[model samples]
Target: MLTKFSVTAAAEKFMRRVVRFSGLPSSAGFRLLVRTGGCSGYDAEFSAEVEARTGDETIEVHGLRIFLPAESRVLLDGLKIDFIETPDRSGFAFIKDDQRSVVAVSADVARIDVSAIGRG
Candidate 1:
């Protein structure tokens, strides 16, 4: 389980839009999977899912239901998630509580991970 996980307002808003427009049922939640990748400590893939996958734990940040796998839960411990959008790009940025972005996953590359590949 995560010892600490936080999301900024912008990140929350972004997630809400994703869920609301995902075309899934109203009960659908955002599924986030993170792994070690590249120079940064993390790489992430996310999607709106109708429900948590097997072995996933559902956590609520405010009202958004987030589905996280075991590895992701450990990776997200003590991190804060934020959303950043600019003229050139938009994506979710992961930051340690006392540092800058550890990794930024591009929205353009975000995809559904039904296969659970590369997890852990």
Candidate 2:
């Protein structure tokens, strides 16, 4: 599922931030999997995988490496992840190319100027 869009800078930043916030053990790579749990019968999961699967596509963006299975690469294309901090707390967010969900930003994350700290 090779496309013109491999990964974006904002996506890379999201991964780096997740690593720092998770405090998980360091390894050579990260894995983003498409699991079955969401209302759409699919959910995105982040984990540490020691190695990439043979059918996985390795995306290296801004020094952050992520491996997504060939099957997942399809749904993940043109997808961007971001972190949000509401009054309740902080959590991750997602955006797809097809359309914006109620929770979607409906804006360009690259224009948001998300630095080390959160900005509205």
Candidate 3:
């Protein structure tokens, strides 16, 4: 089966740190899922799991197991997972392997459409 996403070496190291700090067992793995609602219309969610759930596709990179749900396969194809640390923030980030920016709109611009938003 084709790989839907990739985990960077830095990400692997970060996962190891997380596992060590969280007291997760050696068998622990990460699950990546796609959910609606983000600047680009979708978001990648991560969770720690002890074992693969039904319909999950497991991919191991350098002995680290990363699980992807069958439903999220298409949305996450060609994705690159990395760990970034900065003075202000430090965490995992998902980037498109194709190099496209995740934020579809410019940060300086505000897009608001009254017609598109309906009141319940």
Candidate 4:
């Protein structure tokens, strides 16, 4: 029912790549969900969906249909989905517009502190 989230051009481009890589139908879109228990208070989930479910709010961008379930509407509002690529990492990120923070649910790289290894 609520429509507050948006998808960036980079995200749309990434989605298309996902579809091609996964061999999903062109009509398929992404479903955004939120769940508890993560480094942060909540975690964002993404899945490729062929059709929208009942009670789902659909946001269309560049011929892509991004579906948000009713339950996740509140938690995901005012967020922007984007695809970022750096020399060391690349993946999807959820940008919290209001908080000015980025939450990455899936990324190719992880941070490590070599100095902290085997130290007490």
RMSD (Cα, Å) for all candidates, in order, is 6.0, 8.5, 10.9, 9.9
- Give the whole-model CA lDDT for all candidates, comma-separated: 0.77, 0.55, 0.62, 0.67
lDDT of 4 by residue, 1-120 (tens): 556777778879876655444445778877767655566455656666778888888878777777888777876678787778888766667788778788544462232223322322
Determine which window of 10 residues in candidate 1 has minimal summed lDDT.
111-120
- Sort by lDDT, top down from the best: 1, 4, 3, 2
Stretches of model 1 off by over 4 angstroms after superposition: 100-120
Off by over 4 Å in 3: 100-120
Error of 3 at 43 (Å): 2.7
Q: How high a TM-score does candidate 2 get? A: 0.57
Clashing pairs in 3: none
Give one digit per residue, the lDDT tens place, for model 1 in 1-120: 544789999989988777777767778898888888844556777888889999899999887999999888888888898887888767778887777645555454446444433223
Candidate 1 clash figure, as a count: 0
Error of 4 at 68 (Å): 1.4
Q: Which model scores highest in TM-score?
A: 1
Write out the backbone clash pairs for model 4.
Answer: none
Q: Which 10-residue window of candidate 4 scores lowest in summed lDDT?
A: 111-120
Q: Clashes in each model (backbone N, CA, C under 3 Å)?
A: 0, 0, 0, 0
Tens-place lDDT digits, model 3, residues 1-120: 566677778878866654444445777886767655666565555656778899888888777777878766766678776766666655556677677654221121122223322233
